[model samples]
Target: MSTPQPQTHQQAAPAPNWQSAPGTSYTSPIPVTRTHLGHALTSEWTKIKSVRSTMWTLGVFLLLVVGIGLLVAAQTNDNDYADVPYTIPAFFGLILGQICLITLGVLVVSSEYGTGMIRTTFTASPQRHRVLTAKLLIFFVVAFVVSALAIGFVGLVTSGMHGGASDNEWGGTVLKGALYVSLLGVLALAVGSMLRHSAGAITAMLGLVLVPAILPAFLMMSESLRTVGDKMMDYNAPNALAKIFEIDSENGGGTSQLVLLIGVTAAAIAGAYVLLERRDV
Candidate 1:
């Protein structure tokens, strides 16, 4: 009351040092690491796993490959497998299942473009080649692994039910069939990157697989085109798969199909790289 308290003045806090020292550059608090292909792969893996469409497509693929395979196996007796591998049943299912993989491959890349997410992807990884490579590798590995698992499962199930467990060739046959199916997926992915529209790319790939398979029959009416028609029928997706399973009349092993698919995929990938680099995302 009586004594007047001395006034206290709080000195203002010195200005925060937001600026760097004269000779030093400010370092970010977060650590920075140099990016490489591994980083790109990790990113691609994350993207593929997070998408719902991937799950749905793979789900449908397994359903077709496994369900139809089991159905085929159930309908047959041991005699049906006398000359064929237990994996033969899987071939019938895969004929349709391959379409699922093809569709998924197209959606993988083209969907990004459709949703305007490619810009974000490109911004995150400026090396378009690296990005594409990551996508290709991830997609191929996934396709192959899933195909192998589904086909192998059916083979094992049929062997147990109908008796072909001792056959040594089934393992190699399953691997070869899975590889063929995966390559088809890779080709579809390459096509997707180029077309960048899900519907268009899907249509184009369906045509690539289905058209050649059909044209041969129509072409046979023309005497001049008969030779070409025969060749197309022999060298096509369904034929290749049939040969792999030893279910076709031609009995040609599927080497030519593998070689042909590899060449086409390489060309498409090369083209994808060029267009990705040159075009605006």
Candidate 2:
């Protein structure tokens, strides 16, 4: 048996430096803040800007789009435009420039996977979906803004060269083109997330964009496949951009193309979420 000892009282917990939410108490002295989408956006923006890939890709994109656009504008006279929009010049440059944006989209997610940084990212965010959402949002915004500026600049130059009386539609057309390119990059990101390999995702995206335009020829050879071939030819990315600029007027506007791409991107993103939540880093 042991000798009895005097009882002691426990001290109360210290208050946090900041006030807690109503009816909730946090005992730790260190201040705590709730996480939200803004935090994730900031993190993603920081990561995207800090990398060299973003710089190189965006730089090349601007150079090709702007340079090619100006060159085309300089060579063409107002009569060459006829019923077409002045923004038509920008379309040629974007045909090649979009590759850079697509590549950047693939690098955004796949690079993290390649370097084992996704594990750290998931550990930090905890909610895998939030990180994915943040990446999509961030990439879309950057891609859209940069694309708009470059396209807008080219449009302005083209309009200045051929300042016809009826060239008032440039603003709306420029925004629409930018939207298409940005969504394309987001689709690339979705593909990157699903594949988790940069080259494969990029190649797959290239095929997705290019094959439809080319395969239509072979597809058209079959009378039964002709309808499908016609649709693909009409709705392919190049034609979509061309349609937006009024360069492909006989085929209707780009509204169908945008709607189709949005649907596809939504489906790809849904699949990416499923894979992200189920698969280990």
Candidate 3:
């Protein structure tokens, strides 16, 4: 007391929970795993199958393909199928039904862009190319399977209805036609990804499928351009499918059209990848 004892203060110790422990690691409650193409594929599959647009488009497609096919089969005499493959009737339905596929293809990616869902998609995945690849894989497989089934159904019905008139070699033609339609859907998907606009891409694809076949008729008025128009008609999508179905076509053959479509689809896919990488999400 006489010394007026020097004041001694005790500092508050930091809480154990707040202190960082050396060499200690923290693990989150949520499990972490690396993402891959499989995850992306599952996500895309869920998206495509769950959407209303997919159901509506595919429903109309099946209706057109199967209904018109049956109608065509009913009207034709069994003897008429001798000259043409029984699968030839599938062309009428497929050509019109193809519009549904093109719409769906554009919607697959473009709808995401339109709705701003692409931001969430890119944010979650971070790899644009992988996302696009998954989309392509999922879309192409679905398109191919659905088209094959519809075409196969029509082929079976046509063959059964016109049993005596069916050619033995119609199998290859039916398979080829289905493949061609699926490829067109893939092409539409690539176009959708590249353009990223639904209406614009749909219009472009419609023109791609229809213009070459229709423009030639108008070009006949021009003496010089008539040959060019004729060439366009020969190489059009309808003529390509007609060639596959063994229908009367001035087109060279399905092989050339298949090769051309493959090349163009490849180029478009490459372009989409490059553009996706360069552009901001």
Candidate 4:
């Protein structure tokens, strides 16, 4: 009987490492992967598409650009110059569309901070430059697509008025306009990153782009200052960048203006990056 009892006993198999001990809890770290910019871009794309503001903003831009262009084209008399670029009237809505694009781009970064999601993003990405570059990539893609849509729509709508559907130029002027608008979008992201406040950044951007534009309208007294302001408006600041879109202009010939505007854009971006790198998010 003792021999039989000894023979009946057998060893049990080991429990899996995944299994918890009796009366103990089991926890696992989230399977996080270290991602490069492409992943970050994909993530950002998801976030952008998930938000309603993006869709609404683009929708409004499309409507205003195409709608105003059609209206202007239809209302035109024969006196309009034949030298005018096929999509010239589209410029009427461009300034407005760009303003919206800049605001939206700024919010893409600033709003994340405002909502405390930036911390989560940084934590997930861990690489600062990667994060910034990813954001830049995502923003550029969106801007390019939106710009193309706006220009294409305006060209198509205005084409009908300019000599049927085939007359659209789609040349240097349209390309320059798209580039200028896209750069503004990038500039917005940079500004927002540095400022970290929407109202302040938007206000500053408006001042940078708008105040100089309206200076003549508001300050009509000083002749010397007026002369200077006229020069400033004509070809010495960001407004000169607009000249690139002017079909009538010979090629944004104001070298000083282009140089100064470019320098400012570079400085703004660099300043923003420095601040972002140094400051606490």
Report the number of the highest-TM-score candidate.
3
RMSD of candidate 3 to the true fold? 3.3
Query: Candidate 4: which pairs clash?
Result: none
lDDT tens digits by residue: candidate 3, 1-281 = 58888999999987678556898877799999999999999999999999999999999999998999989988988888877777777889998988898899889999999999999999999999999999999988898888888888998898888898755577777678777888888889899998999999999999999999899999988999999987787778988888878785344447788788889889989998999999987
Candidate 1, superposed: residue stretches over 4 Å from native: 1-28, 164-168, 249-252
Candidate 3 backbone collisions, by pair:
none
lDDT of 1 at 247: 80
Location of the lowest summed lDDT over 10 successive residues in candidate 4: 247-256
- Candidate 4 lDDT over residue span 22-90, tens digit each: 999855587756666788888888888888878887787777767776777788753463545556666
Tens digits of per-residue lDDT for model 1 on 13-109?
9999788779998679999999999999999899899989899999999999999999999999988877778888899889899999999999889
Using lDDT as the measure, name the better of candidate 1 and candidate 2. 2
- Model 1: weakest 10-residue lDDT segment is 164-173
* Clashes, model 1: 0
**lDDT tens digits, residue span 83-171, model 2:** 77777778989999999999999999999999999999998899999999999999999999999999999978788778773544678
Per-candidate local distance difference test: 0.90, 0.91, 0.87, 0.71
Greater-lDDT candidate between 2 and 4? 2
List TM-scores for all candidates, in order: 0.89, 0.89, 0.90, 0.79
Candidate 3 wrong stretches, greater than 4 Å: 1-8, 14-29, 249-252
In candidate 3 the C-alpha lDDT for residue 200 amounts to 97
